[model samples]
Target: MASITSSGLGSGLNVNDIISQLMEIESQPLTKLQDKAKEAQAKISAIGTLQGALSTFQGRVLSLSSASAYKSLKGSLADTTIGTVSTAVNAQAGSYSLAVTQLAQAHKLKSQSFSSVNAPVGTGSMTIQFGTYDDKGTSGNAADDTFEVNGDKGALTIEIDSTNNTLTGLRDAINAKKAGVTATIVNDGSGYRLLLSSSDSGKANSLKITTDDADGNDTDTAGLSRFSYDPLGTKNLTQTQAAQNAEFQLDGIAISKSSNTVTDVLQGVTLTLQKVSARDTNNAPVATSLNISRDTSGVKTAVEDFVKSYNEFVKSVEGLSFYNKDDNSAGLLNGDYVIRSMQSSIRSTLNQGLGSGSYYQSLGAVGVSFDDKGNMTLDSTKLQKALDTRPEDVASLFAVNGVTSDARVSYVSSTAATQVGSFGVSISSPATRGNFSGLAVANGPITIAEGDNDMLMVAVDGASSGQIKLSPGSYATPAALAAEIQSKINGDSRLKDANAAVTVSYNATSGKFEMSSNKYGAKSNVQITATGSATEATLGFKVAQGGTGSDVVGTINGEPAKGDGQVLTGSGKAEGLKLTITGDTAGEYGTIGFSRGFASKLDQTVTSMLSDNGLLRSRIDGLNRDLKNIGAQGNTVTRRLEDIEKRYRAQFTALDVQIATMNSTSTYLSQQLSMLNNLASGNKK
Candidate 1:
C-alpha cells in the first residue's frame, strides 16, 4: 500500500525527481558491483567451455593410445562372390589359397504326411536324443556327454506327452523347450507333416527320437511311437538333409569344421562360407585368394581425429586466455598463470620425441606437424606412405605394443611395471579352472519324492557362498529340473558378495550331477553340502573328481612372480607389473615389451590436466570461488543501497510537508491583512 503524496506540489519544486537523481548517484557502487559480478559469471562460464574442449581432446588422445587402433587388420577376398572374411587385431599380414568344398548344414528330418495338422499322434512319451550316427547300423550316443542343462552343460532330453499329442501342439512344446532341435509343421501337397531340424550345424548334433506308447507296445499305430525316428531302427522320419561338416583346403592343407563359419581354422581369421568355390573350366575347384593386411586407413583416421581435437582445444584456450591488442582488453582467463603453465607443459610434452632408437621417433616423422599458430596439421600422403613402407615404425610412433614373438607364448595385460621397457615371461604351469562331479548314477535321472527338499550349499575359491534348493520331482526323463537348481544358486542375492558362481550340469553319459565354479585358480573350488532333510551321502553329492583349480606358474623379468588363475604378477624388478596369459600355452616362455608412444604420453598428460587436482579443474574451482565472493559482495552493496534509498525518501517527504505548512501559514497571514486593509478603505470612504 503506497501513499499518494505529491512532495513537490507544496514546495513548488520536483522533490521526487530530485531524490531519484540523488539515489542514482548513491547507487554508483552498486553498478560497479553488478559489473564485477557479470565479469565473474562470464569467467566461470568460459572455464566450463574450456573444460569441455579439454575433455574432448583427452578422449581423442585415448582413442589413439589404444593398441587396437594401431593393430587393426583387414581381410580381402579375391572373389567377393565366393565369401567374405574378417580378421582380428592380432592377425598377421599374409595370403592364403582357400578352396571351400562344402557348406555346413543342420540335420533336417521330416515325418510322414498326415491327414491334418491337428490330427492326434497319440498319448505316451517321446525321448529325443542328440548324437552322430554311422553306416554300421549301430547307433552311438555321444551328444549326451556335451549337452547343457540350464547353466549346466551335458546331454539333454525332451519329453512329449498326451497334452501335446497333436502335431501343432508338439511343435509348440518342442519350441518352448529350447532344446537342440527346432520343430515346425510343413504342409506338403499331399498333407501336413512335422519337420524337426537340429539347431546347431554340427555332425555331433544329429537328432534321434524314440517313443514309448501308453499301451507298452512298440507297434501302436496311434501312439507317439508313430513319430519315432531311428537311423538303424524305426524310420518314420526320413532325413531330408544330411548332418555333415564343412570341409575345405587351406594352402593345400585339409581342414574341416562343423559350421560354415570357420574361426579356429586360421589364426585370428573368421571365414564365412557363402558357397563352395566355383568350378573352373577343368572341373577343378577354383582357389580363392584370401589376403590379410594391416588396416592403414584406420590408423590414419585416428591420427586425423587427434589433430582435429587438438586444434579445437587450442582454439578454446586461446579464445579464453588471449589478450586483444586492438581493443586493449584481456580475455576471460587473461594473465592466469595456471593456464599459461598448462599451455607450456602441453607444448613441451609434444616437443619431446619418443621411439628413441626407432627410425620414426616423433610426430613430425609420422607427418603430424604444428603450425606457427599452434594448430596441428596432417600430411595424409606422407603418413600413408610411412604406414605402407614401415608400418611397424609408424605404429611405434604412437604406441609400441609388446609383441608376443614366440609362437607358443601369448601376452595378456601389463601393469605395475614400466610401460616402455621389455620383460621376460616364463610359464611353468598354465592356469586351469576347477571342475567337480558328484557320484555317477545309473542311466535315468535320480528322482526325489514330494516334500523331499534338498539344500545344496556351495563355496567358490573361498569367496562366494550360495545355497540351492532342489524340489521334489521326477527328473529321470526330462532334464529341465537340473536347470532350476542352477538358477537358484546363480540368482541368489547372498552369493553375489563372493564374486563367483557355481554351474550345475547333469552329465548324461556319466549319470552324475556336476558342479563347477566360475573362476580359475588354485583356490577356486565349488564345495557342496546337502543339508536339512537331505544328506550328501544319500543325495550322492560326493565329489567323484576335480576339486581344486591350478594357478598359473610363471616368472617375469627373471624375478619370481605370483600367478592368480591366468594372471601373472611380477615382484621386485617387475614390481607394479602384471600380465594375463591366455590359451593353452603352458611351459612356454617369451619376452614381452611395453612402450608408451607419443600418443600415450600425450594422453596421460591431458588426463592429468583434466583430473580433480589438475590445472584446469583447479582454475575452474578458483573461478567458482571468485564468483561466489562476487555474489556476496553484490548482496552487501544492494543492502546498503536499499538503506540509503529509504533514508533519502524519508528526509524528502519531511521537507515537502514543512514547506507546504509554511505556504499555508503565509496564505492565512496575507488573507487576514487584506481583510484589515479593506475595512480601513471602507471607513475612509
Candidate 2:
C-alpha cells in the first residue's frame, strides 16, 4: 500500500485546523507593533494641528509690530465741495484755514480753421519747446510777452514729410512721439482745426512752437509755419487757455503750487483743489476749515484681534493636551513636552517688560494681561483711556520702537540683534556737502552776450551735464547772476536723468559765486568742466574742482560704528541700531533708548517654535523615526511568524502519518492471529 501524503488523511485527524490555530497565537507581537505605529501617526497629526494654531497666532501678532500701524491720521474738510483732503502717517494733528483762489489750468492752443481734416500741409521740421512766458504788461497778450525755454523740458523736433503732411497724419505722428504735448483734431463751426495742449499745468510749462517751414517763410501764416507760436517773434496759433498755478491760502498765508494736487506745502497732508473757493458779499475768499486728528480705529481693531487670537490659541492648546481623570481618557498629545514648552515660552515673552524708563513698559500697562486660565484678557475701558492719554506710548508697548533725547539724532531703524537699552551717540566728524567757490567778479551788472559767455558745462556728484545755454541778458547784481546759473545747471537733461542738482549762491561779502551739490557723502562733488570764451571775464567762472563731501564718522555705545552719508549704525551689543545724525556739531549728541514690545518679541518666539529645527519639528522627526523602526521590526516579526506556521504544519503532518502507519500494522497482526486460531481448531476436530 502507498503511504498517505495528504495531511490528516492517514489517521483521520484535522491537521490543517490545528496549524492555523497555532499560527494565530504566534502573531500577537506583530499586532502590538502595528498598534504602536498607529499611535505614533496620531501623535504626528496632533502636532501638525498645534503648529497650525501657532502660525495663525503669529500672523495676528505681526499686525501690531510695525510702526506704521500707530501713525495713522484722519483728515476732514468743512467744505467738501471745494476739494478732498488725504493724510499720511507723518501728518501732524492740527486745524488749518484754507481758501482756494484759483485751480491750475494747462496751456491749450488751436490752429486756424482748415477746409478739411485731410487737407495737405507743406512738409517741414517743427521744433517744440516748453518754457515760461514773462508777460511784461497784459497776461494773455502775446505781443507783450517774452518766452524763455526750459532746459529741463528738453526740446523735441519732429519731421513732417509727404507721408505725414496732412492734418490727421500730423496728429498721429506727433502723438507717436509722446513729446509731453497731446495733439487732437476738433471740428469748429467754420472748419476742422488741430488742438495742442501742454501736459503740465503751470506758468513755467507753457509751450513755444517754432518751425523751419519748407515754404521759405518760417514765420508766415502758411504751410507748417502756421503752427508756430513764439511770443517774442511769430504768433500763428491761437491761445485758448493759459497755463496757471493753483493759488491757495493756508492760515492767512499765501501758497502757490503748479498742480491742483498740492503735497509739499504741508508736512504730510495732500490737498486736492477742485474748484475756486466761494466768495462772500464783500468779494473776499471764503475759508474752509481742515481738521487733522489721530485715527485710533485701526489700532483698536488690531489690539482686539490680537487678544481674540491669543485666547483662541490658548484654548486650542488646552484641548490638544486635555486629560479626563474620571475615565482615564487622554488626548493624542496629552503628555507632549514640546507643546507645553512652546506655550510656556510664549507666555513668558508676553509678561516681560520692554525696557527701563519706557512709557507703558509692558502689555499690562496698556490693559492687556493673561488671565488665570492662560487666556489673554483686555480691559476696554483702560485701553481707551491709555489711547486717549498716551497713544504713542501704547504703540510702543506693542511694537519695536526707539526714542532719542536730542532732536538732531533721529532713530531710523533697528533689528532683532539690537538689545533693549540706552546707548550713547558721539560724533567724531560731521558730514559736509561738496561745494565750489568761483573767483570774484571784476564788476557788477555783468553782460552775458550771445555767442560769448552763454554756454557752461559742469559735473555734479560724478554726473556730467551737456552744454547749458544762458539767456542773453544783463544781470544787475551777483545774486541775479547766481540765480540764472543755478536754474540752467539744474535744468540740464543729463544731470536731471542722473538725479543730480546744484544750488548756486552769491556770497556778498566775498564778492564771488558759490555752487554746491545737493547730495551728501563721499560721492558728492561739484566741478566746472568747461566754459565759453568770455565766461571767466563776465562771471569769474573757470575750469576748477570743488571739495568732496565726506561720510559722518561716529561711535555708538562707546564702540566703533559704521557711517554712510547721514546714517550712523551701531556695533557690539547695539548692532543694527541706526540713527540719522543731522547736527553739525562733533561732540556727544545724546543717548538712544531702544525697546522691543510684546508683539514683536512674541512674533519671534512663535516663528522659532514653528521652524524646521524647532522643538515641535524635532519631536515629530523623532516620532517618524520610531514609526520607521517599528515597521522594520514588524516586517522581521512577520517573516518569523510565517516560518513558525510552516514548522507547525510539518510537525502535525508527520504525527498524522505515524499514527496512520501504526493503525495499519495493528490490522495486519489481528488478521494473522485469527487465521492461526481457526487452523488449530480444525486440526483438533
Compare the candidates by lDDT and give the number of the best one. 2
List where candidate 2 sits over 4 angstroms from the true fold.
1-6, 111-196, 208-233, 442-451, 470-493, 505-511, 584-588, 667-685
Q: State every prediction's TM-score relative to the real structure.
A: 0.73, 0.87
Consecutive 10-residue window with the lowest summed lDDT within model 2: 148-157
Cα lDDT of model 2 by residue, 1-685, tens digit:
6767788998787778877777778888998999999999999999999988999999999999986678788889999999998988678899999999999988999999988989987889786777777887746666555665554465556789999999998888778767578999999889999999998898878888888799889889889999998767777999999998999999999998878988898878998889899999999999999999888889889999999999888888888889999999888888889877987898789778777625777777778887777778888888878877776667677888777788789889987788888889999998778887888875477788888998889999999999877766666667766766776787576887898988887788888888888887788899989999988777778987466888889998998988888889999978999999999879998988777888888988988888899888999999999999999999999999988987887887778778877888888888998999999999999
Q: Which stretches of model 1 miss by more than 4 angstroms? A: 1-5, 123-132, 136-154, 212-214, 217-222, 341-345, 348-362, 385-421, 433-520, 523-547, 555-562, 569-578, 582-588, 595-624, 649-685
| lDDT score for candidate 1 against the true structure | 0.72
RMSD of each: 8.8, 3.8
- lDDT string for model 1 (310-332, tens) is 99888888888889799988788
Per-prediction backbone clash count: 10, 0
Error of 2 at 511 (Å): 4.2
lDDT (C-alpha) at residue 433 in model 1: 75
